[model samples]
Target: MAWKKDDLFLFLFIFIIVSLYPCHGNFSQANNKQPNFRNASSFSTMPNSPYDYIVVGGGTAGCPLAATLSKNFRVLLLERGGSPYGNNNISRLENFHQTLAYSTPTSPVQRFLSTDGVFNHRARVLGGNTCINAGFYSRAEPSFVRNAGWDEVLVNESYQWVEDKIVFLKPAAPWQSAVKDGLLEVGVTPFNGYTYQHINGTKFGGSIFDNNGFRHTAADLLAAGNPPNLQVFIHAPVQKIVFDTRGTKPKAIGVIFNDENGNQHEAFIKTDEKSEVILTAGAIGTPQLLLLSGVGPKEDLQKLNITVILNNEHVGKDMADNPSNNILIITPEPQNQTLLQVVGITTKGFYVETSSGFGINNDSIVTVKNGNMSELKEIFRGGTILEKIIGPLSKGNLSLVNTNVTSNPTVTFNYFAEPEDLRRCVAGVSLLLEIAKTRPVKELMGNLSYTDEMLLNMSLNANINLIPKSGNETKSLPEFCKKSVTTLWHYHGGCIVGKVVDRDYKVIGVGNLRVGDSSWFDVSPGTNPQATVMMFGRMMGVKMIRERLSAG
Candidate 1:
């Protein structure tokens, strides 16, 4: 169905009702008064003994940092959102995606903004966006890692350590074969055992260990071990960073946060007499928090009447993001297949190099195939080879509008800003057209009426508008292409590495403050970033420990 603005709103409203109405029943069944395990009070509240290290944002990196750091130090983790321990929204994987989309506009889960003044999405809850994301995992490409100025030995060690800690796996069942066939036909290839592969013009592998299910997230990782030394404080928004200026070099001593009940409390990091602070609060939160604490651009701080501690102009400037657009192909039949049932193809020609020297330097392309008939006939049947020849590619980006800390900043992603991106997407769509011509898929296609108008409408908002349109043209391919554009939910690059933070993940010019999250990515990984974020988190953890030990 062509999703008109009204249709989109209706779908969203129904989704919201379905997701929220059921929560009341679940909440009634569970005791609400029981102290939430994710809150600061659930753990030791002895403010008398300050923690050895304090980590902010108990989501992707924060959770692991707390778990790993607690092995040697008393770690305090502060989270602004409530825990998803027994939340139904997080239990089932499919429900996770649905709930996430519904919560994007209103919930304080993740931050979202539109460059065209249209849409915005962001997660403000614990586990950050991970609690409600499509759980695709991938590590950074070796070349990408090398560019970060780290030694080969360190990168290898970090990858190996992270892989083990996260238990990375690959998809092996028939579903993988089916999806692979579909993608091969389209020309999009999978990454060759690298996280930072060129995606502009290549066919590569999609990141997946098993095509049957989603990977684990931060909550799953932390809950599995339940380490004793770590304390998680959820629903406590950090108001400001308390810095101790007594010494020549100012150090972040503690944090002040407001709980859900409107009560404020202060927690100090023992810092072993000189402890360090790690901010894994994600791209949006990390920058916002820093600005709120007067650590951003001097001019902007002055305008807000806030005192500037660090005059770093680049604190929130070099904002970048992978442009993501979604292309939905209507299958002739309703195949009882989930997203996991699909195969991923990573083509080599998709990624190209930009003037920038960053690895996977230019735009990234991802093509998802929809073959309902083939899937219905054989649960694992890879679509006919022709299907791969024509598939659609969606593109988007991460951008910042205003630098206000209180308001959720705009995050407009220019989904298909580059002509090359659209060319690749058009090719993918052509491939899908071929697949529809096949015998099995043809039967389904015959029953379905697909008009050029519908296709244009669907593709337009998907952000694939490279085709030119003439005022007099009807529903020509070029005209249809000219009318389409879209946005992606994957938010990244507000505080990229090398440009924003130093090689060790430390915010430059700031003493003892570091960031370890998706925001630290110098460029958006051409693929899903769950694994990459976790790996970087582990790497940051190692760096933090080493720095603290050396200082002590």
Candidate 2:
């Protein structure tokens, strides 16, 4: 078997040339140019061709699900918004927060807006709301995850698996440290060693993870590996879900959507095969899509002149959101000093008090570390019952006011509806005020007065006045509470787990349909939701792959 040096060189050269050959004819040409589609809207034009899996909504969940499923199955991802990969406005972290206001008109980040006109938050871009999110990546509380009805083993395994993939970065800069220390002085505690945790607690410190290093998004995550079987269609709005009822089990055959040019087209599922159709279109879009396709409450559909396929009353009920109110205190003399500046300038802020409470019986309330007592007192006297209680208790529903899928759905969150909800909020605010007066924090507050004088000015002027209060104030606490109410933008729980989708995320009454987004959360995590959403998306993806493989 011994060969000469020339013979070995010739063999290697021939092997390299053969390996470079394309599997199909003209593969090299196709790789160099775009597909033969007439336009960007042509993806929906092909109604006869079927796909192995049709995922609606290429958002946080849809994008990840499509990317993962494409490893073994052909996936068709439909996105209502344009791509965010190279979009300048969405690519940068600083620009992301600014785009929140315009997400609904053009992006995929739009959720339900509050009726009081205080909070208008959502994203409508290709990356979903993550495009304009605060970008805090922390895991959910263990108790909260268990509440979703999933097994403990499954929940922990899912959390670890997702965290490894996303890999959130801790705050390493000094400015972040300053903010964290300031928050600590005011009684905000870190929860679960992560940013987003607890259903109703104040989070002082949060970790800043570069969402894909400025491109942190589902689109980027999925597009990076570039699997051959995956195809993503942007700016394609799913108009309807066509169902095949001939078989014993109802099957979603395909979807019909509209393109940027107002042209309609249908994308049929591949024939003779049962392809699972997942609806990761998010809380509002998914329900709206279902209702439009005649798969919602029977009476509601009849009113709209659409035939009902499934009468699921829980489709849009139980809407929940974290309504936040800020309690800004004037530091004695701008604690933004050298040490604080160094903390903020050098490293990401440190997270204090990761886990404080222990559950009594797994479901019962557990007493945890009480954050800064002085700050709690300030919040109590300054904030109102409406801000504390009713804001937390009120639940809203999403309904289709119009048939247009692109049109914004009517999202009404009856914030501050219940008296008890208001009462709880008042208690929480009272606690915050107490924390502000503590020695460690009070020492930092020099000459600045906490009174109703500054509140009156900010409420009247409609501007964020961070200035310290004057030493004089005769107005009562009740007076300031009435005029200085604000709202938080952390919305959650519209399509809750068990209430909307089953434990497996499969729609209760529908076949071949699933939801994996913030809407699936049983309750709001009382903190930033970016991390929680990513975890849920990851869990759903893993479960989906396992289920498909088992069936095959």
Candidate 3:
């Protein structure tokens, strides 16, 4: 094997080229043109030119939808937050909590405690919640999507486009293995090997976290976007959708927005007939924007002084949050790190999952169940069994805090307000406790908190309301769950499919306007909805492309 001079030179040149690259070719190829992703000011000074499509809120759904739409159309994506690129807290798996704890008003994640005291954060950045969530990725159930009146073929096939761009297989570590074993031991049943499909019984799923522990999100999906067709303006929040009513009914013609500097600007639709304003803003932002733009319930808009364009009663009603409770198990030693790898999908109306290597530093702060901040205790270093119960009967609503776009929309998840919801929580906690008692998990788990009186009654705050009766309150699992149940941030169905948007994702009464996001759910999917949100984004992208071709 003699090396020729030309061959040696060629190898050296390619080696040098890769070495000069920032990520050693580890990231998506489209990421090399990162200059295309920029602050809002870049577009703010440009002369007025209407986009073929305008997507508001460059979060989970918005990014993918806009990126896909930009393939042939001139798409303008307005993101309220900065780029997720180069942010350590967002990219690293270890800083999962750090991103959430970044509580500054301008932080990418907008931390808020709901009226019921459940802690949650909304993504203020480009990838949306995908940039800050637990990074679990699972496809929506086929049955669920079919019932939503989606094109069954498109819905099933579109997930690969998203999975290819961002989703990764989470390798099960010791903790995850134990979790899988524990779930199987407790008869969660029918072990399906590692899969992306939403299946019943126990399984291992994918995540957005790469093997190197870097996050790949909707931002990465932009890598596939045609740079010239796509223009993303970060730190620019859409204030309201502007409508033109000279025709049969009002159509969203443009939008009013503010740059990072708080300077106001306007952008409009250009591709006539097909020109559209899509709200990929999440549950909160999507409904909030629609309501603010005078397309909500009649009485609510009148009270807020917003001129009603459409009297649709279903804009922001039927809001539901995926209720989740964390059961922490103290390990004899620091367990291996992993995301939601092993999970139990039970017929009992709940799903059990595990999170390891949360890796919070001792000095890092934690927001308690009561919304008070305190230095994180050492006990949080262990593994966690995070359980989310489906089909909660407790649905809440969101409306205008005021006409001000910047004002946070008044929100209430209304967690556990329904007796059925409380019952599900009790059942979920009991199942997890049963799993914890299994030999595999028992070796590592210790101490589930509950009050004896509360356990006997299976009621929350009934006999044990602020009484602090003895017998190690921390041992009562039911009480701890009741006091500390939080949202998985898997909120959906705000602008529901049937009531708000049709199967094509078009808003019922509005012209040239569509809503595609987690909020479009007829009912929330059983798994983490990031994959589903991305699926909707992908579907909208495909639909728009098909419509354009047909019109031509």
Best model number under TM-score:
3
Worst 10 residues of 1 by lDDT: 352-361
lDDT of 2 by residue, 1-552 (tens): 786654443332211111110001111211222211123377644443567888888776676667767777777777887766556556553344334433346554553434443334455656676565444444555666667656667656755544544434443332234333444555454321223323223332232223223435555546432356777777788898988776775567788888888788777666644476788777677877888988777898899988777777777777655433323333423222110001111111111111100111122221112122232112211111112222246688878887888777777666556555444444444443444454544454445444434433322222121222342211533323323333334455555666667777777766666666766654554234555665566566667678778987
Off by over 4 Å in 2: 1-48, 107-112, 151-167, 172-215, 224-226, 247-249, 270-274, 329-392, 431-447, 452-489, 494-500
Clashing pairs in 3: 108-124, 449-474, 449-475, 449-476, 449-477, 450-475, 450-476
**Cα error of candidate 3 at position 254, Å:** 0.5
Query: Model 3: C-alpha RMSD to truth?
Result: 11.3
The list of candidate 1 runs beyond 4 A from truth reads 1-36, 41-44, 104-111, 118-120, 151-179, 186-215, 223-226, 245-250, 271-274, 340-406, 414-454, 461-483, 546-552
Off by over 4 Å in 3: 1-35, 360-376, 445-481
lDDT of 3 by residue, 285-332 (tens): 899999999998999999978999999998888888867765555444
Root-mean-square deviation of Cα positions for candidate 2 versus the true structure, in angstroms: 17.0
- Model 3 poorest 10 in a row by lDDT: 15-24
Candidate 1 vs 3: which has more lDDT:
3
lDDT of each: 0.49, 0.50, 0.72
Best by lDDT: 3
TM-score of 2: 0.71
The 10 consecutive residues of candidate 2 with the worst lDDT sum are: 337-346
Which candidate would rank higher by lDDT, 1 or 2? 2
